[model samples]
Target: MLQRKLAALLILLPSSLSLTVTAQQQTPSNPVAPSQLALALPATASLSTEESHKPAFESSSAEGVIRITPAPQLEKELPSQRPFRTAAFGIKANTLGAGAELATPLFGRFNLRSGVNFLAFAYPFGIDGVNYNANLHFKSSQSTLDWFPGGHAFHISPGILYSKNTVSSAATVPAGQNFTLGDQSFINSVGDPVHGNMSLAYPRTLSPMLLLGFGNILPRNSRRLSVPMEFGVAYTGAATINVNLTGTACTNDGCTSFGGNSEVQASLTQEIHKINEDLKKVPVYPILSLGVAYHF
Candidate 1:
């Protein structure tokens, strides 16, 4: 019995000592480092390693969650930096005749056109034996500044051509018929018949143009119809002729008074100085057009 009691006491003592040692060892040795478990989390469950690799239906607004993000795309304007947005209206023909035009857009590729043209006619002729009756008028007006270049439809213009062309005539010489002036030769007095009047003018009524074109009546995408064509020159100068005669003429030494003939007014001033030296060798005036346009 004594031995059994001693054994129990020793066992109890050992058990108590063991329990104390175990408690001391359970505190912590070295397993908690993900930066110490993210500092024991809870600053809203702290997560950073790039928010634990984002996109878990990514949210924000402090988790009241609201972030859609997909609107921001507006920047489009480059038809040569558009200007005067759009405008075009046209109708045309050529050689300064039937026309009506108006175009706008004056920036970048540049444009600005304007127009007006008209024509009138009536002619019936015979020159020398003189029996004319002509009347031709062609009014005009223009304004331009096109230049396309790289935005090409090919163009280049620079203009201003305002004219009111004319050519009037009304002459007859049938009483004994026969005529000629500078070189002198005439007849037509019987009952006085050799009345005359002639005119042709354009001493200069604004002209200074230069063009070269090929389609493009304000066209910068979204086409709204176009068809334009041009070729030009206009420096209108020298074109003036005027002649007037009353009646009575016949020379083989007889009737006279082509206004009291001083040799028929010096052969009508040498036939108006040889018809103004052949219209000063044409001082430009030739343009060609063709069109149909509409835009807005």
Candidate 2:
């Protein structure tokens, strides 16, 4: 029994030694170094230094914080859009007579306007004491600073009116025709035909104008055209009348072409007095105007 057992051990020992040699020849995929095994972890389960610093995406299974970065947008590089700033226009009986103006946007919700106007009209009339054929004329330049208190669509305008207001007249002591002086009618200065040239002017060339207006003649935000309306008062000073006489006045002899008679002078003075009374009723003029404007 002992001899048989010794032979069996010899055969198994050789086989076991051969298997050990084969395992040593092949390299281990998960070899453990001193540092890797220090934390009591398997070598195959350990992380590299770089891998340890990386953020983990697996929720709950990993312990780490992640950061996200956004890309830039192209729209932010585009230019900004803006509104209209200036305009030109033709205006009616407002600041300037019948003329034109230019408007420009000033600071916030304000507009500055400048322009000139001219107008002339003729009329035939007979007052109880006066005979007259006259032309009324107005020529002026104006400027305004407008404030849009409500909106750009409505405005309060205070302006400067620089104007020449006049009335040119021709009158004659009606030969056979009755002439009205004021309340007095004169067929002739004493009894002969008399002729005179008359002109009326305002003492002030500059006046104050205030108006409440509507419509954005030149619009900043709207794309359409606009029509504006303005109504106001112009404070024109007292009227001055000038009269020049020629040809026949009251004379002891009769009506003559050139008469320096005291009667002639007295007649002229009376006529002037009557005319002055007629002007006293008006001092402030009413202003109304309509305008169309376009912007670019």
Candidate 3:
């Protein structure tokens, strides 16, 4: 009876142990805590590549934001350079007026002249018979060619001039009678007796002249007054083709031939006679003048 009881108790203990092991294997493990999940999340990502490409600056308490690069500055240029200059020219004024250019180098090589001039002169009266007076009026239009030849000291100008001179006279005749007379009585040895005569004289003249001159310059600048001495010769002749006068005269010396009568010599009466006087024209002559010149 004791042996059987011990064996039954051992078998029952073994079965109970097996049952406890199986129950523990079927149970699930505990879930993780919410706080631990929050800690495991990735930190915020660094600035992206797109953001890094843009301009960037650092903010700080000690220094304000500083620009990393400045905008391109506009280029400046100076004005194009050129030389400064003043313009100039030469002009002259003279006695000849604005047109009257004294031969000077200011107006390049050529010169022009224009003006009015007055001439008053007297020449010896060529004849002895009567009284004579002469007056000349000169009007001129001219152009000149100047030759430098060397210095400004000298020049030559060839030109033309037109002029007029008037000559007039009056004479007293001696009182006398011709003996070729008995009713005709007024005749003498010479064509007519000049013993007593009175008459008026007239001479009118016109002349065209070719002139050439030589001058000596003292010294002057353009627009200044200068002294120049000029001498010129002119060939001039009257416009009238034939300028001649001829006349007959008779003179008696108190001797008479009255039919050869001799009665107390008849007061010594003279016979009438015939005489002739010839006056010729003067063809060409020379003229001289002196004057000053001005330049403006």
Candidate 4:
């Protein structure tokens, strides 16, 4: 009876009775084979593949974020100034403001220069102990030849200067000031100021000019830019000074008008004629200039 009971109990149980060990979140002793795991749990296999590549993806992302890259910088450029030329078309500036010239190499160490300078100015001066003021309206044209005897850096020039310079003034002498017009001493009526009109005419004829100069400001085969200086003189013709005199003056402390006297008037005319005689000694006009010029 015991044998039967044991057998019957055994039979009542399943034919293959074994405990199934399940680990949803634990690693197996031996890892699941790729083929078996794919068949058994496809999601598990896919999750394993994703986790295997996670470290590499993280490493790649880190490399992208933490990189030492040099920044690109930009630079700018500026234009350069040009130097002088050997033969050029140049513009020069001096006391005359502006003038244009053509500079060409003629014979060796020689250059021909021709240009004109003009200006209208008012100049006041004291000449031969006489105070004089005049408006200078002048135009001077030069036909000069430059000789670079001392190389290209220094030169001596000889030229013809045609000058059309004149002076005109409405002259007034202050009271108590004795002025010499022509060759006589004239005082404004002792207590009154005298007013008169005067004019001085200079020769417009061609005059001789001599100049000593330094530097070729225009670009040559050597230097590009330089400061040019020149000192010269022009032989101006005798000046003809004409004065129209009509004024009132007091004499002998009696306040008599001396301008109304025929004798005084005659004396004034004689004095006026003496101006040409007084200026007979001076006939040269000085020339000096510092200028900048550029070659083409």
Candidate 5:
């Protein structure tokens, strides 16, 4: 039995040695020395350190490769904001317009406006006179001024006015009687007249006013509109004070005043003086008006 076992061992030992030598011949060479191997060992161990600092993605097909990006860092700062602005503009009677201010700037927030107001029946009136009973006329003029302020739409404007007021004075004096112009036989003081003369003359008046104002602001979507009325007194006259009233009714002749002899001549002379005195004394009257306006 011992001899047989020794024989089997010899055969297996030779086969094993041959297998070892063939494996050694098939293996590839190491290119590194002992010191190079030590250096290479550290480089291999440092792979974990490189991976910790890297972007954490790899081309290799690993078993469990997870990617995570930490929450973004947010800044802690205040936001930006802007402020509001004031407003400025002008308007006319019942519309937005530009006009000259006959009066100066008052109340800081107040402004005077002068423009044409083309509205029928806006200011209608009739007057009875000596020659004409009642003259009826339609007044539409080109000269008028308005004054007011932005707040509450309250304003006051006083300037020259050219309006026509007519009345009718047609009647018979009932066959010679002491009936004056006011007598019912001559001209009744009731309604307007039909066929009468209307004159475009200067009249003095104070215009206190109220209005509706509208406005718009672009940069900021803001709007303002209001209806405001105001009452005040004004005098329409010249800033300078100077009077000159003297004239004669000369028929196609180089005028000459025939002294204080002729009653007609004296009456006419005194009439002109009276007119001068009236113009000298300023008329302070109350005024009230209502209108609409727009602001932009």
Candidate 6:
């Protein structure tokens, strides 16, 4: 019985050994490394801790590739887009008179300006022994185109001046007092003073004007107020003088009608010619002004 049992045990041991050899042959000889394992797996199998916690705007593809896209940035503003101030109004004091003005922008570095001026006063003087009360009056309207060459406060202006200016006088001579008109000397008739009227005026009412100035009525920046100053001239042409007399006068001979006297008329014509000749020397009227203005 011992010999039989030994035989059966040897057969079963051989069969188990054969099965173990077969399983060992089917298995791999070397284990895979972590790096190799990762390459072997699908691309979406895993993600890094840092990549998993990224912001929504940043993203990673299923291929394990990172595609970071930056957010859009805001745009900046431009100077031309700023609000434009349209007009300005102001008061001024000038050689012509006290006045007010309006200014408006026309285009880049250009402006339009318009204003009016007025002044009236009296002066007393004596010419050729004639006591005269003279009234000087000034009224004018002007318009100009202002140009800023370097986009600065300094500007040049060309314009027109429409004037209603006059110099009028009342002439008188004391009764029996001597006076000269033209080249003739005469005496006022006793009980009758030599009374007359004289007027000086420009031949042209519209004159061309040119100006150079500092400061601007409408500033380009954020300022709301400015002080403007200007110096210029207007070509007004020669002035004309007229004289009329309505009183009695006496020459060496005798008293006669002052208005009807041929000698008196001739003298008056000569005097007028002389006055006009002097005026022709100065055909331009001066302009100077300073002002405060507000812009809107």
- If scored against the real structure, what TM-score would every candidate get? 0.39, 0.63, 0.36, 0.58, 0.30, 0.69
- Screening candidate 2 with a backbone cut-off below 3 angstroms (N, C-alpha, C), the clashing residue pairs are 97-117, 129-180, 129-181, 130-180, 130-181
TM-score ranking, high to low? 6, 2, 4, 1, 3, 5
Give candidate 5's whole-model lDDT. Answer: 0.35
Candidate 6, 153-177: lDDT as tens digits: 8999999999999999998888888
Of the pair 3 and 6, which is ahead by TM-score?
Answer: 6
Best by lDDT: 6
Segments of candidate 1 deviating more than 4 angstroms:
1-48, 51-59, 64-68, 72-87, 90-99, 102-116, 119-136, 139-145, 148-165, 169-195, 201-208, 211-262, 269-271, 274-295
Cα error, residue 32 of model 6, in Å, equals 19
Compared with the true structure, all predictions reach lDDT values of: 0.82, 0.68, 0.35, 0.63, 0.35, 0.85
Off by over 4 Å in 4: 1-100, 125-132, 175-193, 218-220, 253-262
Runs with alpha carbons beyond 4 Å of true place in candidate 3: 1-108, 120-128, 171-223, 238-250, 253-285
Question: Candidate 5: how many backbone clashes?
Answer: 12
Listed per candidate, the RMSD to the true structure in angstroms reads 12.3, 10.9, 27.1, 16.0, 16.0, 9.8
> Pick by TM-score: which candidate is best?
6
After best superposition, candidate 5 residue 134: deviation in angstroms? 6.7
Q: What pairs collide in candidate 6?
A: none
lDDT of 4 by residue, 1-296 (tens): 99999999898665434322334235466788878865786454445544565643232231132234556787432111121224544455545335555555555567776777777888786533335578878777787787888666788889998777778887666666666543445556645566667788876478998988897644346455566778888787677787665566544444334458676666667766676777766787777777665544
Q: Candidate 1's residue-wise lDDT over 78-152, tens digit each?
A: 452366665789998988789998888888788888889998888888666767788889999999999888886
Instruction: List ranges where model 5 is wrong by over 4 Å.
Output: 1-114, 118-225, 232-235, 238-261, 271-280, 283-287
Q: Give the TM-score of candidate 5.
A: 0.30
**For model 4, where is the 10-residue window of minimal lDDT?**
76-85
